[model samples]
Target: MSQTVDDPEGRLVSMIMEANKYARFAAVCDKDGNILWNSHRNNVDNILTLDETKQSLRRAAETWKVRDTLAEKIGRGQYAIVGYEKIKRITVPLQNGHMLFVSIEGEKPEYIKDIMKIVDYVERNH
Candidate 1:
């Protein structure tokens, strides 16, 4: 009951991979909240958890709908939105039109900062 879109390119992939290593848990989803890619997932659990799925979707929708969400920020050429979650600190608004959901075990502002760097790097290249 879902669909997937194409993936992000350039430094985004490398940046996500880097974040996974440091964060220990991370996920990337499309604007519609479909799973496009994930790291440390043994059996694609994020798609299975209904709560998480909804939360992911909310993040996406807010980004696209709200005024200050990551999607809006990226759309307006502002800073990338870094979401601080209980089990994760994530970088959002992947690429120009996609969404990224990262879940790390511990709090690492540095990791989130790194993710922002990736966004900045990608935007510059694009």
Candidate 2:
């Protein structure tokens, strides 16, 4: 599969998607909200669109900003989680101003732990 310049090897996107079975959507984006690689499960009703990806990236950037500011005031942030009526978004900051984002249906606590494990694995390997 072809990957963007930011994700030449597509490792980040692969990592996100492989993190858990419940992951409805996953993507890696730069700090400026530019998508590097995006993936979603087939046969899903809520397909991720270009505009939605852009919006997701923008929200992730904003969340990062808040995380950084809060970290400065308190301590380093571990991760950020945003819950919606239908899906929950989990974001982890990666190296080189890149971020890994995953959206899952409903609220599953175990999914968060699984995704975090993948995040740690990516950080260690990549």
Candidate 3:
């Protein structure tokens, strides 16, 4: 039987970390870019300060707004990725109008495939 969850988003952040070895951080944020739950893998160093991270989330939310405007013609967006020198930031829209952010190590082409698998897992289990 399935177990009950008191904080699903927090649980989801933990699960996402377990699902991928390269995942450095995972967070669930509101449509307004407010983070509801988040987790960072132990021993991983965050390159951005807290303020920078918050700004990035807000920008991700704004980018989604633009995508929403185009959805009528191009269909809905699945996810967006921003590749930096050290890491790749991925943002996905949740069914409940929240956003999921995941950051993984950079410079690996295979990480994209891994992200696809994670997204599928989330769709099935979360």
Best by lDDT: 3
Candidate 2's residue-wise lDDT over 10-118, tens digit each?
Answer: 6656665655667787777888778777777666677456797789788878778777887767886667788888888888787666777777888764677777776
Instruction: Give me the runs in candidate 1 sitting further than 4 Å from their true place.
Output: 1-7, 41-51, 68-86
Query: What is the overall TM-score of model 3 with all chains considered together?
Result: 0.85
Choose 1 or 2, whichever is better by TM-score: 2
* Model 3 accuracy (lDDT, Cα): 0.79
Every model's Cα RMSD, please?
6.2, 3.2, 3.7
**Sort by lDDT, top down from the best:** 3, 2, 1
Span of 10 residues, lowest total lDDT, candidate 1: 1-10
**Ranking of all predicted structures according to TM-score, beginning with the best and ending with the worst:** 3, 2, 1
lDDT of each: 0.53, 0.72, 0.79
- When 1 and 3 are scored with TM-score, the better candidate is 3
> Evaluated with TM-score, which candidate comes out highest?
3
Q: Can you write out model 3's per-residue Cα lDDT over 59-79, one digit (the tens) per residue?
A: 999899889999899998888
TM-score of 1: 0.56
Any residue pairs clashing in model 1, and if so which?
none
Q: After superposition, how far is residue 113 of candidate 2 from its true place, in Å?
A: 1.2
